[model samples]
Structures are given as C-alpha cells and as structure tokens.
Target: MTTNTLDADLALRLAVEDLYADYVHTIDDDRLEEWPGLFTEDGIYRVTTRENHDNGLPLAMVYCDGRGMMADRISALRTANIYEPHVYCHVLSAVRILGASGGVIRARSNFSVLRTMQEGDTSLFAVGRTFDTLVEEGGRLRFRERLAVLDSRRVDTLLVIPV
Candidate 1:
C-alpha cells in the first residue's frame, strides 16, 4: 500500500484503539450509561465462551442489540445486579481490523481482565479476544457490534461490564 493508504488505515486503527481504551475506562469507572453511548442505535454487545462459539452453540453471558437493550443492561446493573466484592481492570492489546461490510468495520483485539478484592487479593479473572464491528457515523466511529469471547468459564463473580 502507498504511504497515504497506510496512513489512512493507521488513523482509523488509532481511532478504534482509543475507543477500546475509553471503553475499558468507562467500564472501570462504572459509567454504565455512557458506555452504551459508544455504540450505535442498533448496536450489539455480547460476551460468550470461546468453547460455545467454537462449538456453534448460541450461549452468552451478556447479549444485547440496540441502545434500548443496552440501557436495560445498565438499569439492571445499577438496580438489580449484585456480585462479589471485587474490581476489574481490563487491558486491551493487538487491535486490528479484520474486515468490513458497507460502513461496518470488523476488528479484533486481545484482552486480559485482572480482578482485585477488598481483602487485598488480586488475580487474573479472564483473558480473551474482543471481536467488534465499528462504523463511521457523523464523522466518528461507533461500535455496531462487540463480542467479548472470554476463554475462562465458571466466573468467580458477576461480569457487569463489557470486557
């Protein structure tokens, strides 16, 4: 590719990179309402086991389509969700665009989630890849779909945010 083409891809990649980073921040800060704003009105969010995906079984820990569903998630989290005493720190790496269709750009990235409790304990809660579809809208990129394929099942506590 020419330098211009490369630069274009890089720019787009960086934008998505920052979005991924901001996503981690939003989840960590418990800004759940703002979390859904990162996505499009018809966006999708899901977290599933790699085993289930590989086996072609449709099972997921969190699955939502559209901002309304995402809103409901936030409501449930704030008003109804409960979990063990711990905080999750998520780190994302190796973000790259895998493909695209129309305005949608599909991407993948590796992620590691670290957990800490009030008892002065810490450990790796889960590690996996985040598969996402982004679209450029109103001169900005937004998530149209995101699938956090966690490698670890039998989670210790509740997963209330996107990984």
Candidate 2:
C-alpha cells in the first residue's frame, strides 16, 4: 500500500476504536440517554444469536430502529422495567475494518461484557461480535447499523441493558 493509503487506514482504525471506547463507556456508565446519540437519526441496532444472524433469521432478542426507538428503550428501562441495577465492564478486541462503500465504513469487533451486580457479584454477561456500518454525520462518526451477534442463544437472566 502507498503511504497515503496506510495513513488513511491507520486513521480509520483509530477513529473506529475511539467510537467503540466511547460507546462502551456510555453503556457501562449507565448513561443510557447518550447511547442513541452514538447512532444516526435512522440507525438500526439489533442483538441476536450468531446462528440466527448466520441463517438470515429476522428474529431479534432486542431490536430498535431509529434514534427515537432507542430513546424509548432507555425510557422503558428507567420507568417501566424493574430489575437490579448493574454495571458492565466491556472488553473489546479484534476490531477489523471490512471495507468502505458509498461513504459508509463496515467493521467488526469482538466483545465480552462482564456484569457486576449492586451486591458486587460479577459474571460473564455476554460474549458477542458487533458488526457495524458507520458514517460521518454532523462531523462525528455515527453508527448507521449495529448488529450484536451473541455466541450463545440462551441468556441466563434479564437483559435490561444493551450489550
């Protein structure tokens, strides 16, 4: 690759990694209101089993279309949903840029989230890979689409928070 190409790739990598870091911090810190701002106005967010995603199944454990729907999720969590308050520690790795097409960048990243209850008990909450399509919107990188494909289909407890 030319020097320009290499530099561009490095810049992209850093920007995407920063986005992931910010996203993780938002959810982990329980700043739910800020989560939707990470995405575009008409973004899509979905969490599903790897098998289902691979098979092209439309079934989703948690799915939201548009920032409004995402905001609704936060509202429900804060108001309607009743669950123990917990915090997540996310470990993300293997962030790879798949390609860029039509002003959107495609990427994938592996993530493992550990959930800690208010009682201080911790456990592996979720292991998944996120596939994302990103675009620059209003001078910042925003997720146009984000799909979290969990390795296991069975969730042991209530999934009140996004992974």
Candidate 3:
C-alpha cells in the first residue's frame, strides 16, 4: 500500500493517461453508463466552453457534480435525448502532471474530438485540454474532478456523451 516517490510519480502519471484514454474510448463505444465509473463517487465533472466559464457566465455546457448527476446524464442520453448520430474519436497528447496537493492530483492534457456521421460527413467537433484531479478510490485511481474546457464552442447540439 506504499509507493516510493519515483514509483508514485510514474504510476500517477500513467493512471491519468489511462483514464484519459478510457475516456475517449468509452465515448466512442457509446458506453455512457460505464463512463461515469471512471470518476469517484463524489467527483465533479464539468464541460464548458472557454467563452462561458471565462466570461463568468456561471453556466456550463454540461455540469455534473457527483456520480449520481453523471448517471442522470447518461440516462438522459439513452432514453430522453435525440440528436445527429455520429462517431467520436479523441486524440490526446502533451499530458503533464502538474503536482499533487493534499489528496488531489492535478493534471492537464490536450484533446481533440473528431466526429463522423452515418452519411459520411466528418469534422473536428471539439479540441481542448482535460483538466483533472485524481485520487485513489474503490481500490483504484479515479477522477475526483474533471473539467473539459473546450476550444470549440460551436457544439452542434446534444453532447449526450461526455467529451
């Protein structure tokens, strides 16, 4: 249950990367329910465009505080939502673990979301950096807070799946 300084650092970095990868894959797979499992029970997940969160609009394109709210999001997507059917592919790089504070680990990485539709239309939907906090929970590393600050705010409606 003990990690040396070097091992802790490496593991923490790898864990965050794995989480980020799984994040992209899960959305691509349309596994909305399992997506929330990547977060801690008490985690916070927010999706906001730079214009909004920066201008103090006090609104997020999407915001879920706690696993329950995330779960609600998935539910809405599955049963109560309708939108253009598309596929998503996320490309990430430049991941840097800033440091740790108390029980929280801070990290940032670049992300690009590419989408394709059934009719063969493809485009870059969003590009951004994932700002996250991580911690050990349920015997695993999980996100305690995740903010997807997008570079593209032209959300084409129905961000049912977490970006």
Candidate 4:
C-alpha cells in the first residue's frame, strides 16, 4: 500500500473507533436520546444470533429500519418497557476494516457488554460481532447499517435495551 493509502486507512479506522466509543457511552450513560444521531436518517440496525444471520434468516432480537424507529425504541424503553434498570459497560476490540468504496466504509468489531444492576450485581450480558457500514456525513462517520450478531442464542432475561 502507498503511504497516503496507509494514512487514510488509519484515519478511517480511528474515526470508526471513535464512533463505536461514542455509541457505547451514549447507551451506557443512559443518554438514549443521542443514540439515533449516531446513524443516518435512513439507517438500519439489527441484532440477531450469528446462526440466524449466517443462515439469512429475517429474525432479529431488535430491528430498526430508520432513525425514527430507533428514536421510538428509546422512547419506549424509557416510558413503556418495564424491566430491571441496569447499565452496560461495553468493551470493543479487534476492529477490522473490511473495505471502503464510494465514500462508504465496511468494518467489523468484537464487543462484550457487562451489565450491572441497581443492586450491584454484574454479569457478562452479551458478546457479539458488530458488522457496520459507515458513511461520512458532515465530516462525521454515521452508521448506514449496523448488525450485531450474538454468539449465544439464549439471553438471560428480557433484552429491553439494544445490544
């Protein structure tokens, strides 16, 4: 690879990493309102099992077709959904930049979410791979699509929050 190509790749990877970090903090800090802003207006988000994703199944744990839908989810979680109030601590690593073309970037990363309850109980909530397509909009990387495929199919309890 050329020097300029290497520099561009590094810059893109760092931007994507920052986006992921922002996403984690937004949710973990209970700043749900900011969640949808991370995505494009017509972005898609889905969480499913690895098996289901690999098999091309339409099933998903949580699916949102647009930023509007994502916003609704946050609203529902805040006002309608009744579950244990908990926080997630996300650990993201192994970020792989698959490719970039026509201003779109494809990437993948592994994530582990640690959930903590009000009573101080903590557990490994989820482990998954995040497959993402990002676009540069207003000089910021915004998610065009994000699919989180969980390694395990069984969830301990209700998944009120998005993974």
Runs with alpha carbons beyond 4 Å of true place in candidate 2: none
Q: After superposition, how far is residue 159 of candidate 2 from its true place, in Å?
A: 0.6
Ranked by lDDT, top first: 2, 4, 1, 3
Local distance difference test, each candidate: 0.84, 0.93, 0.84, 0.92
* lDDT of model number 4: 0.92
Global fold similarity of model 4 (TM-score):
0.96
True-structure RMSD, every candidate: 1.6, 1.0, 2.7, 1.0
Local lDDT at 76 for model 3: 84
Cα lDDT tens digits for candidate 2, 14-120 = 99989999999999988989999999999999999988988999999989999999999999999999999899999999999899878799999999999999999
Residue 42, model 3: Cα distance from true site in angstroms: 1.8
How does each model score on TM-score? 0.91, 0.96, 0.89, 0.96
Model 3 ranges off by over 4 Å: 1-4
Measured on C-alpha atoms, candidate 2 has an lDDT of 0.93
Candidate 3 lDDT over residue span 52-163, tens digit each: 7678776887889899999998898778888877888888889888888786789888988888887999888889878888887777778899998987667876676688
Steric overlap count per candidate: 0, 0, 0, 0
